[model samples]
Target chain A: NAGVTQTPKFRVLKTGQSMTLLCAQDMNHEYMYWYRQDPGMGLRLIHYSVGEGTTAKGEVPDGYNVSRLKKQNFLLGLESAAPSQTSVYFCASSYPGSQGKETQYFGPGTRLLVL
Target chain B: AQSVAQPEDQVNVAEGNPLTVKCTYSVSGNPYLFWYVQYPNRGLQFLLKYITGDNLVKGSYGFEAEFNKSQTSFHLKKPSALVSDSALYFCAVRDSSTPGYSSASKIIFGSGTRLSIRP
Candidate 1:
């Protein structure tokens, strides 16, 4: 099983340009999340979804939006990319309840460079 | 708030020697700690976690972590290190006492530690 897969392993964007990052998980997880990894910031959540058709803000959600139209897919969109958005983005998914609470499978990560 | 700290920015150890990566965390209630490893340009892989029971939690790739409630630390250790063990290690924590599932269930990660096992 391709636990979690992200589209466009790498991308370059200019300030103000908009793009959507696609995240797909085949594990049939009930929770999905988007996080950005910076040099010294570890991983900061941008947005998350508890289930399909449900999305909520996270620690750093100001410049990002997300959609979980399907249980297996979660998409993060940068409406107006800024240089500050240049970072490694990761997608993760996990099952609900206590069983899978501590374990989250992550994607390879997408490296975004906003010029 | 919940937070995690990886004291060392990097650690160097000889292959075949024991290795330890220190991690400390702060949480209001019971802490669910975890360790994750990331290779160059790769995603994070779960190593092990401490929810309850044994303080010494063994995980993937021959990794183990001891949870110290009093010290509030979860340090990753390996009996003998391998060159392939050189990678970025992260320490994370989550508050298990949180009533129900929400964004509060999110795990907080430490800055990270670069572990280099020299051969």
Candidate 2:
């Protein structure tokens, strides 16, 4: 299985431009997450989906939106990209469990640069 | 609130020397600890985790971690360092008080520690 994969591995956008980052998983996980990695600031949660058709705000949800239209896909949208938002974005998936399935599987990551 | 800390900003070691990366955490309930490695221009990869039962947790790449409940620390360790092991390491924790199905089962991560091994 591919586990989890993210599309558009690299992208550049103007301050007002908008774009979407797509995350897909083959593991049939019930939970998905979007996180941004910045220098000296570990991964910060942006948004998350508990299951298909359900999404929630995370620690840093500003300037972004998320939709989980399909069980295997989770999409993160940048309404208006900003230089401050330029960071490596990572998507992860996992089964909602207490014993063994909580180990999150991460994607290769998508590098974004906003000017 | 639950949090994780990696006090060392960077750690350096010789190829054959033993290596240690320190990590500490605080949680309201039982903690599910994890260690992840990130190479340059790559995403974080799961190395190991400490859920329960064992005080010493073994993981991928011949690495291991010792969970010290009294100290609230889970330090990653290796018997011998390899130059190829140079990378960034992150420590994370999830508070077990939150139900597994809740969206608030957030995993908090440390800022990260850079490990460099010289041949």
Candidate 3:
């Protein structure tokens, strides 16, 4: 199994450009999340989906949108890319319950640059 | 609100010596704690977690974490430091009652701690 896979491993976009980062997981997890990693800031949640066809806002959802139309796919979109939006994006999923039971599994990550 | 704190920005250890990366959390009610490690240019990898049962939790790569409920802390530890272990570590937490933890809560991560192993 491919665990989790993120597409567009690297991309560069100009300000106001639009793009979408795709994340697919074979784990059949009910939860999926998008996070951005900035220097010195660790990882901050951008958006999440609790199940197929459901999505919700996260801590840093200002410039992003998400969709989970399929059970295995979660997509994060940048409608208008800004320099501040340039960072490494990660996708994670987990099975909730027990301690250590919900350890989130992360994707390889997608690096985006906005100039 | 649930949050986590990694007090040290960086930790240095001599190869073969024990290593520790401190973490503390703030949340009402029971807390689910987790530790993750990130290597250069890669995604964060699960190191360990503390949900319940024993206070000491063993995880991948010979790493473990001690959950001290009284202290609101979950510290990651290893018997020996390896140069290959040098990387960024993060602590995360979520209140057990949080909806996100059930079907809606997203994990909140700490700023991160950079660990270095010196030969």
TM-score of chain B of each: 0.96, 0.96, 0.94
Superposed model 3: Cα runs more than 4 Å off: A97-101, B100-103
Per-residue lDDT value at A89 in model 1: 98
What is the Å distance of residue B14 in model 1 from its true position? 0.6
Model 2 stretches astray by more than 4 angstroms = A99-101, B103-105
Taking all chains together, each candidate's TM-score versus the true structure is 0.97, 0.96, 0.95
Looking at model 3 chain B, report the run of 10 residues with the lowest lDDT sum: B98-107
Best by DockQ: 1
Cα lDDT of candidate 2 equals 0.92
On TM-score, who's better, 1 or 2?
A: 1
> First chain of model 3: TM-score?
0.95
**Mind giving the per-residue lDDT tens digits that candidate 3 earns over B1-119?**
67789999999999999999999998877888889999998889988877789999999999999999889999999999899999999998877775534434546899999999999
Would you list the C-alpha lDDT of every candidate in the order shown?
A: 0.91, 0.92, 0.88
2 versus 3: better TM-score goes to: 2
Cα shift from native, residue B10, model 1 (Å): 0.3
Instruction: Please give the C-alpha DockQ score of model 1.
Output: 0.61
TM-score of chain B of 2: 0.96
Lowest summed-lDDT stretch of 10 residues in model 3 chain A?
Answer: A94-103
